[model samples]
Target: MGAFTQMIMGYVYPGKPLANATFEAYAMMCVDCGLTAISSFKLGLYMKIPPKAMFLSQVIGSFIASACEFATVWLLFSSVENICRPELLPRGSQWTCPYNQVIYNNMMTWGAVGPKRVFYPNGVYSNLFIFFLLGALLPIPVWFLARTLPEKKWIRLINVSTIFIAGASMPPVSAVNYLSWFAVAFFLKFVVYRKYKRWWAKYSYLLSVAIDTGVSLMAFLVTVTLQIHNVNGIDWWGLDVSDHCPLATCPTARGVHAEGCPAF
Candidate 1:
């Protein structure tokens, strides 16, 4: 959340010595999000409202969101048989539990153990530390150019966050996964929003919500079926099946002395 806040603050309001500004922007990030209730009142833009009423509404809304998030997570965890187990949830499995696994891995990597070892000499990804400085320095030029020109819309696209975010995200969502997804999102948001303003205003967010909700419902149904199969000892088409391709993950590590397999 601090990183999210930092990036948003940098994007919205560029500052001198952007690195320091970024670090400072998230001072409020550590604050309990629910404790700060003023922003919630801004939802009613054109009306004068009672603070107590707004606070109540905000609390209720937060409660709903929190409940839904927890329920969804529990629903998946309960229904998915051997979730987060790669052996059960193969490459294209419907219940791979990627999100949960990512949280676990991230906790292991940077939670208890500090990032020093990972970014120090002889570390596997020590080379990535250079990008941290590079990323921090990037906004200076963009900010300078924007200040000079002041009218070029294209200047906004020269965001350092874009480059570094893409670099980091590419490994998880490889070319095959993200190329077409990004292209479609770009076209819809940038092109369609400009060309079909009315349609976009009416349907863009609506469509996104509908699609996401539909997918969630479908996944829930799939999860229920999986749980049922587990209890009944019935077999069906492997809903959690995939290519199982672990490219660059050597067979030697898996007890196979295959030729050209790099043992880590």
Candidate 2:
């Protein structure tokens, strides 16, 4: 949502960081709020809840949630020292705003630098244009195969839309996150469903909701109680580890030397 809107809005208001940030915020909120409404509506339908009641609930909930979110952001920015400045922050500081750093980069990349330079037809990143072609062409083959080989059940599994949307999380999302989801989904959807069909059918959706809610509550409680009080968690080798390869940012050239990276 932020990326798509920033791409167009950036061109519209080039070099205006304030405008870029403003539009990015609203664009993301619109997407998330809209999706939440849709998902809640579907869940209501599944649970045989009245549509009017569901709509009313969501309307009230959205306002409350938005207010709380605004207050939280205001408090954080108001109280936290060097809130979003990673370089200025102390080592191992919990206030190093990684997500905000991404937003700041987008503001610079699309708003200040402009897509005209970054995605220029004959520029250094010209290869990035291939994705546009791939997005358009990939579905055609799937459609053709599905049509021609209608009897082949496997052809239907090639969902191009799902494949495209799968990368929606990839910019900051790690592969381990996807693997964890895949592992759990395989066990529940395949193994559990096959072995205990009745139990899976009864608790699957509820279990998903419970797990999501539990994690969210736990994080919120920890943030409010421990983090806000400057009480740090115990750090061990495992807890202090960075979840990335050391050579990931190293230059690949024959005579290149990157600080803190082994010479190649």
List the candidate 1 regions with Cα displacement exceeding 4 Å: 1-54, 61-79, 90-92, 111-114, 121-124, 149-152, 166-177, 225-245, 250-260
lDDT of each: 0.60, 0.79
Encode model 2's per-residue lDDT on 95-129: one tens digit a residue. Answer: 76656667777889878877777776424565776
Deviation of model 1 at 242, angstroms? 7.1
TM-score attained by model 2? 0.82
Expressed as tens digits, the lDDT of each residue in 151-184 for candidate 1 is: 8979977877876666555333445557777887
- State in Å the error of residue 209, model 2: 0.8
Top model number, TM-score: 2
- Total backbone clashes of model 2? 0
| Predictions: Cα RMSD each | 9.1, 3.4
> Candidate 2 regions off by >4 Å?
87-94, 237-243, 246-264
Instruction: Identify the leading candidate in terms of lDDT.
Output: 2
- TM-score of every candidate relative to the true structure: 0.60, 0.82
